[model samples]
Target: MVVASRMLFRFSIVWFVAVVSCFSQDSSQTYEVYVSKNLIGTLIEAKIISKDVNSSKKILYHAFKEIERIDSLLAWQIPTSEISKINSYAGKSPVKISYETYSILERSLTYSESSNGIFDVTIGPLTQLWGFNGDEEPTTVPDKKAIDSCLKLVGYKDLILNSNDTSAFLRRAGMSIDLGGIGKGYAIDRASDVLKRNGLTSFLFNAGGDVLVSGYKAEDQNWTVGIKDPRKEDKLLGSVELTDKSIATSGDYERYFEVDGKRYHHIIDPFTGYPASNSVSVSVIAESAERADALATTVFITQGITGWQGTSDEEFLIVTNDLKNIFSPGFKKKYHFKSIK
Candidate 1:
């Protein structure tokens, strides 16, 4: 429950974020490219374009290495991972964790409390009950009794964080944290920092479609991104131009299963232990990919634009299953979305 509560607090604008075709990179020779052996069950590709081609190759290697390092530390599947250790000691005692893990959990708890439990990190119990704890094919419908029992162990309130001691404790045993939702975005953010510090300026870091662009893709053109169409296979609902920003999306169509005319997806609702059905998908644009990722899931769980309006400081677009499009007034004002109809 400790790690689970921490996971869902960040927006997982998963699957809604996609890349569009750009001009062919004839200048590919002037870039540093890196693809890592480390896999987080999520795709991570980062590109750094450089005026000085010689330096970029080494930069790319380290950039990808940095992402792999973060993935190793955060992935819950790894038995020796810190999150795994936390779950192992659940309800037993506080286990001292790294400063980075402690920091993430602290912010996670704050978001959980502030979101009124809508965005919870301790949702592991429910996620497991629903069979969302694994990366295999979408799971079958769990019995309602199983869900209720798991719900008893779920809540962000149960994840206790001690800043002074740099540790965390789960109020109950049998609870685990899954960072699958927000960890990708967090990894992207950290990798981006690594790039910036190494003196690379213009590039795109796409970690499993959660995209963050820095500066213009070209002299006068910003990076172009697209949001997937929930109803259509392999088609984009619309595209947006971005520079120095991060955009993420969460949709019902991403990962799910259907049986007897009913559908179940991975975005397990922390409260109901079911897939959130309020919106077909939600896209969030924020200054940080981490925030955008977190907002995408939180807003979808909020159900619609109206529910998200009063609290969110970021711009968003919510597409509900009914085909109604909801855009924040701020989004409508600052950005021009193409004719999506």
Candidate 2:
């Protein structure tokens, strides 16, 4: 169920200080340990505050280990990954997979169906067609005819899940699923579990921009995240305080190219086979990073704030194309948003 409300409020924004700066100041009782590495195509960073530095490093080691395991299992570009294997066996037979991969795929399909296929996992063909799936930047826009053909192979319904045997299959020969939209969030959740299991209560695990935080930054200060202005580089719209929750943001500025004065972004509309144009950016705060990540993409494609149906726990913030800020009712109530002018 959608956990946040659909009601939204707009305001002329103002900015505040970046909250992350305070984390660097040393605390007298606890040692703050920070670690970062390149993983899952982006930087994964973590901050652990503990009484012992050795224990903090140990906890981070286990956390990173869990994340690396998830990347190996879900990364589509890795030939040995279960996702790649599923794509390889498309239209032929079901490939048995790990419970973790199967469960994540099942959850991904749920978002796809709930979002009316606007957040499809079977968007691999379209991603590759626009050259957004690879290392090199796309220099030109793809042909409309080519896009139309690729769209035929892009449908979440075509991804068949056999829960009984823990296997998955793509019904069409060319249909493939890319977990890129949701995998990192799932990984962060897994890593968070590792931290908790190690008896670490205060830590923040961030995979790229998807963040899951628990406990407080200091004694009572909640961890704060800056919301980036989608149109302005190096400028933040505001900051929001969070604890024991996850937040993810999706934006056209993340990956895009301009051609003939038109900007083509990575977030594609499955129905139209082009960049979704409803909103410039969408940020979702949910109980799990997985849900926040998928909902961010779903809401971005489904007309931004207007497309969102709220649940008690999930809240969202959207920046319209005109650069106006829209906040979910729960978001406004739950988080103290310090906006920048």
Candidate 3:
């Protein structure tokens, strides 16, 4: 879980969309910006191009409300959340959950299975063990025995969902689930739905590093989003022009603690119960923010682009731990990325 203060730092190293022009030369085509600092443990920013100011403000309000609802339901840190109930009832009995929570869990399980447990939501135990659960940061590396113990409780296969009762059960007593890897993307998608339903065609919605854009930023120009270089604070690897698409980036810089010149990030491997070291950063572009978020984490945990076997609809840019940049053929062809260094 990213805290509000750390989320600010996370945004600096993660990707950022180019700011939409507030005032268009044609006064009739200006955009309204909406920003919220207290939602989803990170910044929520949206720019909508609308003619009716009242309607757009109302729509933005509802969009944020939708995100808040999700955070209340799925946030593991919240004791009243459904996720907490499921964790509390682990190995005891099934805990009834809302449809939204159940659906996201089901979606998470799909990614877990497809990624061969590389993207497991059952990594909650490992997260807590390493002190990366936003409660505290680890001063020293955890013992191997402790990591192994946590690994025992970290398997997506042990999570069971019952559609008939709309319930979830964790087979092990200490097993837990954290939706941090994919929840923001789901929320962003839901918010995007709200804007589209209100008949807004052009918008840019970003929560943390999860971004979804629609229509155009201007008359004929697509939105340009910068992909920050994970190695540098104020540098970008490049930018991509996108419309009607979603992009997400996961990097080692988001949350981490250093000990003896080594950095251990929050993106832990469920199998090893330690930070995944194959990739320094990974950015994924997909049709939906949900998929992009999951894929970004999945590739980072696996072997970056070399190990990825994604579908036709997906493209990726991976910065390996060796400081090498790997771009999927489709990504290179479609984005036409130029060197920014």
Candidate 4:
């Protein structure tokens, strides 16, 4: 009777431990990472859902590290970054780079081609001249001679890429490339890849206003993303829902300064050497954050109402400076915009 009672006590303890483990597995985990301070620079926060506690932590940790790595590698401010090296060698010889950097640069060149230079990567000189690149601030608008000189260096065609993704070269000196418009989205996409490889079943990765959601938040519910009003800094224009997709928003309100009552934001028109004026804000949704990010910037610069009508592959919402919204067809079909007004 004593032996049988002892066996029953051990069995109850085992069952209790199993129950506690199950409860822990069903819970959620969250992490926050701060990388920089621009509208392009942002703090990232993510919520990961998984059953394995060890794997969840590992995935989240690695994802944040991946973003930091990308930031350092792509930042033009960092003198030792691969991009900085490339810019340093402009008008000279080809600068060899890692396959990762080569891949992104190659993709950027393609976008620069397709967008007809609206999304030129070689606009760094223009950005710097306007005091928008890195941490520089100018008290007034740049001179016409300076703007014209930078425009000479702002052509995407000047950036030459190699076939093997090993190296790239700039056609002339004084030309530089800026990846701030697309780097955040590329980093977010890579972070998502890390999470998937670590076996996360569900997640929401947000870097400031740029966000990517994987799987459902609940059994059947989607993730809700808030859209800020273009005119009002503290108000929300509406909200959109997403699942297994990414959304990237670029707005004039996110970064800029007023010069004699005229606002100058970061999204510069390569042709005019000035901040784009057609769209006050542009939010894009696509299968990947990289695409969404690139399109969001491209649309703002392109200044078209339909937003690249050649491609129905993604959805977009472009808000003009007057607060008028022009949405892509997919938005009307797939989303129900909730107005906060």
Alpha-carbon RMSD of each model? 15.4, 14.0, 14.0, 4.3
Reference-based TM-score of each model: 0.86, 0.90, 0.89, 0.87
Q: Give the alpha carbon lDDT tens digit for every residue of 1-341 in model 1.
A: 97876665543433223222243344444544444443567677666667666577677777777777777777777888888888889999999999998888887776666667777777777776666557567547988899888888887788888889899999799777777667888888887888789988788888777899887776787777887888886678788888888888888776788989887887878888888888888888888887787778788888745345234447888888787778787775555567465
Candidate with better TM-score, 1 vs 3 = 3
lDDT of 2 by residue, 182-210 (tens): 99999999999999988998889889899
Using TM-score, give the best candidate's number.
2
The local distance difference test score of model 3 is 0.87
Residue pairs with clashing backbones, model 3: none
Model 3 lDDT at residue 120: 90
Runs of candidate 4 exceeding 4 Å displacement:
1-40, 51-54, 306-313
> Which has the higher TM-score value, candidate number 1 or candidate number 4?
4
lDDT, each prediction: 0.76, 0.88, 0.87, 0.82
Q: For each candidate, how many residue pairs have backbone atoms clashing (under 3 Å)?
A: 15, 13, 0, 0
How does model 3 score by TM-score?
Answer: 0.89
* Cα-based lDDT at residue 24, candidate 4: 64
Q: Rank candidates by TM-score, best first.
A: 2, 3, 4, 1
